[model samples]
Target: MPEISRFLGMIIAMYYDDHAPPHFHVRYGDREAVIRINDLACIQGNLPPKAMGLVIEWAMAHKEELEKDWALARQDLPLNKIAPLE
Candidate 1:
């Protein structure tokens, strides 16, 4: 997994494993969730309440970049650098 962004101690990463969708994994402490790229919604697992809120907010703010990165990742190409979110 390559970390692409971080916020509120929640790390957003891309995982390269067969069968995994083009999504980002959010991790905070022991909590984790796989957020789908197409919809920017949590598809699997759970995250801490505050972490989840922050993740959702951050994802929404960076949806465009996130989707673009996901596409590049799916093609096994180098990811585009995303600007840091406030």
Candidate 2:
């Protein structure tokens, strides 16, 4: 997993070995979630409502970069930059 960004102790990352329509992991304290990139859906695990909101906001802000990274992921290429929602 590559640490894409961090905020308020929350860690956002992407796992190259992971599958499907591209997604990222959000870890905040003991909470975690696998969020799909295209639709911002929570495909697995759970995340607190407020935290999820923050993540959703971030994802929206970086949609373009995330989509680009997703394409690279499909090609099995390394991601040079994956910006977080700032």
Candidate 3:
């Protein structure tokens, strides 16, 4: 697992050669979210509403970067660190 971004107590990460649909993981406290890269939708897990909103907002801003990261991950290559939410 490699962490790509973190902000507002949330940790966003991705795994090398992970499963299908191209998704990233979000963890905040005990809450977790698996957001799909293609559609920016939560495919699994759950987070607080406020946390979910923040994650989605961040995702929207970095969609392209996220997709690039996904590609790198799928290829078992090094993942770049994305800018944290500001």
Candidate 4:
């Protein structure tokens, strides 16, 4: 997994050659979720409401960057570091 961003104690990352629907991984403490880049849906796992809210806000702000990172991840190329939520 390659970490692309982190903020407010949340770690955002993507795996090389990962599964479809173009998503990224988010980990905060013991909670984790796989968030789809297209629609910001939670495909798997779970997070606290506040944490999830932050994740959604951050994802909404960086959807384009997330898509680009997904493409790079699929190609196993270096992923760009996205700006974290302030």
For each candidate, C-alpha RMSD in Å? Answer: 1.9, 1.6, 0.7, 0.6
**Candidate 2 backbone collisions, by pair:** none
Off by over 4 Å in 2: none
Poorly placed runs, candidate 4 (over 4 Å):
none
- Best candidate per TM-score, number? 4
Candidate 1 positional error at 35, Å: 0.9
Model 4, total clashes? 0
The residue-by-residue lDDT of candidate 1 on 10-86, one tens digit each, is 78888655255667888888878998866767888998777777787787888888878877777888776555457
* Model 4 CA lDDT for position 9: 96
Clashes per model (N, Cα, C within 3 A): 0, 0, 0, 0
1 against 4, candidate with superior lDDT: 4
User: What's model 1's lDDT at 30?
Assistant: 84
Estimate, for each residue in 1-86, the C-alpha lDDT of model 3 and write its tens digit: 79999999999999996899989999999888899988888999999998999899999999999999999988889999999988
Candidate 3, position 24, lDDT: 98
Return the number of clashes found in candidate 2: 0
Cα-based lDDT for every prediction: 0.76, 0.82, 0.92, 0.94
* Ranking 3 against 4 by TM-score, winner: 4
* lDDT tens per residue, model 4, 5-85: 999999999999788999999999998999999999999999999999999999999999999999888888999999999
User: How much lDDT does candidate 1 score?
Assistant: 0.76
Model 1, C-alpha of 46: deviation from truth (Å): 0.6
TM-score of each: 0.82, 0.85, 0.96, 0.97
Q: lDDT, candidate 3, residue 21?
A: 91
